[model samples]
Target: MKLNQFLRTALVACAAVFTIGVSLSTQAPTVSASSATYKTVATTSIKKAPYHKKSSAGAIYNASHTKKVANLKTYPYTTWYATAKVTLKHGSSKALYYKVKNASGSVSGIVWNKYVTPGKSPFGLKYAKSAVALDVNTNNNVWTKNPNTARPIASLSKLMTLYLVRQKIAQGKGTWSSKVNTSNAGLKRLGKSNVFGGFKFNHNSYTVRQLYLAGLIESSNNAAIALGQWVAGGSTPAYNKKFIGMMNNQASEWHLKHSSFVSASGMEQNSLQPYGYSIGASKNANYVSASDIAQISRHFIVDYNDILTDASVKSMKVDGQTLHNYNNLLPGRKYYQKSLKVDGLKTGYTDPAGYCFVGTGRKSGHDRIVTVVLHDENEFTETRSLMNYVYNQNLA
Candidate 1:
């Protein structure tokens, strides 16, 4: 009897130890973002936890869990600083959550501990005033850094011009073969300057197609102005005013509230004045948020996909002059990646705008990604990083 009793006690103690070990193995070690030696602990998938509000899983909430402060989708692949821990009731049981904030302190809320781990930001994005990556196929605003802040857009104004020209064609008002004369004195002055990529108008005229290709592919200031002039009927001061008004009106129609345009060519008022065009404030340039530009790019590729044929072409022979694409990520270029079929979009620069790019790419049998890097001299490099990161992330 004594021997049997001892065996029973030993078995009970071993079972107790086994249960404790299993529980310890399941609880991950918590690491804060500020930890000098950030260590990661593997976390198991969490079961649904109840909250007082009708909240869904993976939501960041207030202290009392009565309101959801943010959805995790907005900060994709971000490494949040875990500041505090709190225990909240989940039905008859309790669960733990960590209070987390972004490095800038702009985003702060409590999230379930399973949603975060101690590590660097997965994006590792830098070298730009503002940046963003959006998935075209899913329509998910995948990731952003300073997305809403407005900055000068420079030659990107041509995108709006292209959109309008397409609209004009669809309405039967014009065709690609239509001739737009570039014989005005201002055009002559632009050609003399020569730095603006003004078309050498042999007959002082180019079809809408030539100007469109030059403007889209080469960022030609002269081509942009001529296209706008064609749209507004002529290059007179009244026409300049009408064209700028149309640009703003179309922006408003799209509800791009953060976009403001001053010139059709995206040049400063002073620069255009030398070429005999009057528009917005002398010092003011075209200011658009990176997010708004991304939105515009998304609409562009989806509606006017034919723009890609022109945009992806590295060079085009226009009136015996070769126009090379400004984008470096296209095929057979500096930043080209075979897997990342980067095809179309735009590149912009001015002293004020620095270097800005709206780049689009897709992997075969996958959704397209639209990326933007604004006011950075290394626009191409940063855009590549943003695209690579967003593609690897689960934006959900």
Candidate 2:
């Protein structure tokens, strides 16, 4: 009986040892995916395929997100089907990544969930160097990309010029009908330069309202300079200095730290030599941050809403010709949208600034959003996308 009991105990021990061996054999090195908790999304359950849309540059990785499989540009406009979403440990936090692939399975990889959106490929400011979108009424920043970096603003400087002139008008120092003589030889010489888009001001003169419209709508450098001269009482060197000081003071009053102006028209310092202004360097031009531009637009629109009367006008008769506005987002313009009520804002361009735009739009006239894009290859389309994103997302 003792022998039989010992044999039974040995058999039991052997069985336990086998179980341990099996468990050891099945053990695996902890993989990235195994360490991460994830959920598998059924292919049929997906209502909309996601498309790659990123605010910044990133890459697609393997399932474990440990290996770089592809760059973002590899699958342009390719709709992705998400197979799984994994929440991976990243430093002290966690991030979600989606396992995705194209319809034909040609493109497959893991991408950050923030870099994609559902539905069709929408226009994005991804290519723009700097951008911002803000809700004017609530002072909510909807979206921003390098907003505080100061860059050449080109014609956007005119907005400040307009603001100062409007201030003078408000202070009872000038009227819209105030006539500004353009008989200065330097002013005439600058006006004749076709590249700057100025009118013939040799022996001619224009009212404050006309010059204002010309500067805002027509982007006339001479008209802006003429107005600046009027404000400073002359186009002499001392007067130009005074006007530039005024521009800087106004910016200070507005609390804009990333803005400086050398010319009222936003021309480079060398370009303003016709006005007795000495050229310093090619980079000596108006510099303003995208954020500051948006703020300036908000202040101008809030205080001088009437400027939109001329700003919204697509074309105005100036210098015996129809001068069309450079802002293509206006109604009936190149990039106009029926859903958005885009009104007066501004557009600017230069070699250093590229193509820049400060656009304001309303969904129902009560909800206004201001969008700015700088150094954009497609300013109008990007602006449209920003406006649409703000309104559609209800970010405002």
- Winner by lDDT: 2
Residue 68 in model 1: shift from native, Å?
45
- Candidate 2 deviates by what RMSD? 18.2
- Candidate 1 runs further than 4 Å off: 1-120, 280-283
| Residue 183 in model 1: lDDT | 82
For candidate 1, lDDT tens digit of each residue in 170-235? 889999999988888776677557556445656678899988888898777777878887898885
Clash-forming residue pairs, model 2:
none
Clashes of each: 0, 0
C-alpha-based local distance difference test score of model 1: 0.70
Off by over 4 Å in 2: 1-124, 279-283
